[model samples]
Target: MAGLYTDQLKLGLDDVGWVFAIEQSGSIVGALLGFWLTPRVSWRPLIVGAAFLAAVANAFTANVDGFAALAALRFASGLGMMVATLVSACLLARSPNPDRAFGAGLTLNCLLNAVFVWLMAKLLAESGYAAAILSAAGLFGLILVLGLALSGDLRGDFEAPPATPESGAVRLAAARTGLAGLVLFGLAINMIWVFLERVGLSNGLQAGDLGNAFALGLLAGTAGSAIPFVVGDSGNRARMIAITTAGLVAGIALAWWATDYWTFVAAVAILASVWNMGLAYYMAMTAENDPTGRYTRAIYIAVVAAQAAGPAIAASLLEFSHIGTVFAISPLPAIFALLLVAAVAGAPRVEGSSLAR
Candidate 1:
């Protein structure tokens, strides 16, 4: 939402980058808190409290007067949302089909984002920025209510495994590889994503056209997330990751070569879809590696940190080089990360496959 209204927020590119960095920094902190609390605290109250905190933080954004205030509010919102997400991930990791569970979560997220993006665009056209922000706040408030209504037995389903040094070492090593891959994958996606609007405008696409394309891209992402949900982990995940990485590179190439609106739309759609698909696979892989939710929290932190770094690094590169150079450099990390995960995946499974208990 903030990305769509830079003019109204009176923010420069540097300010925008700082805001994102600050927000993600808060998530990293929240992930750390989740890491500590996941085993010690009950999941039900934690998720509900996190959602309420996020809702209150975002609701307060309506009164923000300057970049400082806006950044602070966003930081609070990120912290709350990350904690809620981490608790949810812990529960999903315990499900019968972790891949399908994660995919379904991603699908719902993408669908809601697509709908909200379209609604926000329309709302911004007819109303003030406060109304758009408050609408988001209202949605978070609804999530809080939903969280409250979940069964108390949900927390009982997760029991932290007693740690032994030999098993812990193996699990940590595998989880480390998955975390590395997810960091690079997230970074590569966001580097191009942050500048997509500029790319479209340079190619003669109008603002409205860009908005429509982004919403459509998110909808396409919903479909991509559904792939794992429907298929239910039937194939080799390493091969799927390889295919998705290639698709990410192809999406970036398409964007670089696009000269027309339809081409740009296609590029964005492919990128968004591929990103979500890759994320579901990555999340499932990490969850399988570390069922305790310790490294899972670490994975969340690394991913958010990469997301914060991607655009800042790209912006820095743009000062000295072309956007094409940034594009060329983006996928290299993903390719390296893929190799790391594949190498670890080829090893014997220490834990059972299918995330079955």
Candidate 2:
């Protein structure tokens, strides 16, 4: 949603990062609280409550005129969304086939996000920013209702016994590496994603055209997610990450240089697809490595923190450097993430099994 209306939200690029940062601050806080409380508290009421909070925040978001007021409301909405998101992540981590589960979840999410993007784009065109925000609030309200229907007594599975002290230490180390990798990944992706619509507009594309491109890109993302579900756990996860990372890099480069409409569309689609595919694998790897889901919980924190930092970093960079420089530098974090993932993949096995699943 931020992507859809970021240009219309304000006139300049100078302070745009603050909007994302403030929202992410709330996300990080909510994720931390959700991670701490999820194990001890029942999920049903927590999810319902969080969804309600987000709905209210989003509902009032359009009324604010100042960046400070908008940021505060976005913060509140982030809190609600992050709580529900973390709960869902924890649930997915507990699945018997975490890879497939995560993949399927990503596929579904991407498809839904695409649909919402189209709807929001139309709402923004027809009504205004207020309607777009209100639509998001309405969606959250629907999510609240769905949470109620899906609510039940849920618990994590204990398939394997708790790790020994040494094993726990090893897992913790690996998990930290994975978390760092994820932070870098988030930074790379969000830096481009938050600015993509603006990039298109600057490149001579219409708002409607950009919206359509985004919708198509999201559909491609759905396919990317589906690939992991189709391949399941038997495929080489590390190799998959490397391939998707390469694709993402190429896509970013194309977007940087794209002069034609079709070129931009293709670049956007590839970028969206590879980003979704890469993260699905990353999340699955995190869940697989940490049986207790603590590492998985940390994934959201790293992601939110990176999201807060990425756009701010990009915005600051724009003060001195060209947008092309921003795009060129974007892939550096992803490359570092790839290397970290490779290192985790190569770490010595414990109990005759690789530390990373």
Error of 1 at 160 (Å): 6.7
Question: What's the CA error at residue 326 for candidate 2, in Å?
Answer: 2.7
Residues 251-346, candidate 1, lDDT per residue (tens digit)?
A: 999888777777887888889878877777877777776756666666577777788789888999999999889989989888987888777767
Name the lDDT of candidate 2.
Answer: 0.79
Off by over 4 Å in 2: 1-21, 60-72, 121-133, 149-152, 155-167, 195-208, 316-320, 352-354
TM-score of each: 0.87, 0.84
Judged by TM-score, which candidate is best?
A: 1
lDDT of 2 by residue, 22-114 (tens): 787898899899878777777778888899999999888767666777788899999999998888888788776777888888888887777
What C-alpha lDDT values do all the predictions have?
0.78, 0.79
- What candidate 1 gets wrong by more than 4 Å, as runs, is 3-18, 66-68, 122-129, 153-172, 348-357
